[model samples]
Target: MMNKIFTYSLTLAFCFFSTVSYAKKSIEHCEATQNTTSGLSSCLDVVKEAVDRELQTWINNQVFILEEFALATGRRAALDMFKRSQRNFITFRENDCRWQYLAISPGTGAASAYKKCYILVSKSRIKELEVINP
Candidate 1:
């Protein structure tokens, strides 16, 4: 009887953990894989697709500009910083200026130190726009 109760308790604990671990969320997103960011690959692709569809600029131009800036003098660190902040934009556009519009580049850096998924957009491209955290 004791063994039966012990086994049941262990089974119950495992089931609870498994269910909570596999939950799908919106604002709170986690990788499908175990502690790895590989699952976020699809999420990043979706974000880029949405950006391309809504924006008028050609994908070539956007990529070229991002590359150019990434190589320019005194801007490498800034570009890296932005990339690190954006986390390849997997989390979605942080500012959400569809009316004004903004461009992006793909990478694997987290948005912020405190937040795992944060998208950092260029303030220059977005004139009169403020990048505020909520």
Candidate 2:
């Protein structure tokens, strides 16, 4: 009975560790696969997609708050200003990331750099918007 229990426990522990190791390796596989431009671009695309989703969520929340504020306060101008500010911010983000991309060479790291810049800026904007409440 003791040997059987020990064997089962060891098997369970091994399986658990094996699963954890595989999970980590799968996550690192993208960056570990190759150092090629395309591989890096693909990784950046994944990162950008995640950041874009987060940004969209924050934007949605902010818009909802602004909408409620406009209705409650009867100040449509606030919402309008927010819309304009968002547009201007988008333009600025694009221009800024383009500049960052251009700061590097054309082929190698520019695309990744641009995407990274977008992620960083979008996250910062989310944090900024989080401070505003209805």
Q: Per-residue lDDT for 44-123 in model 2, tens only?
A: 67756665665565676566666877877999897889889999999999999999999995768888788778877876
Clashing pairs in 1: 85-111, 87-109
Candidate 1 matches the true fold with a TM-score of: 0.22
What residue pairs clash in candidate 2, if any at all? none
User: Top lDDT: which candidate number?
Assistant: 2
Candidate 2 residue-wise lDDT at 99 = 95
Q: Report the lDDT tens digits of candidate 1 across residue range 1-134.
A: 46445544654464355336424421234334325444555444443333333221222233334456666654676545555644534244444433123222333433221122221232122211112200
- The positional error of residue 73 in candidate 1, measured at the CA in angstroms, is 1.1
Highest TM-score scorer: 2
Point out where model 2 deviates above 4 Å: 1-34
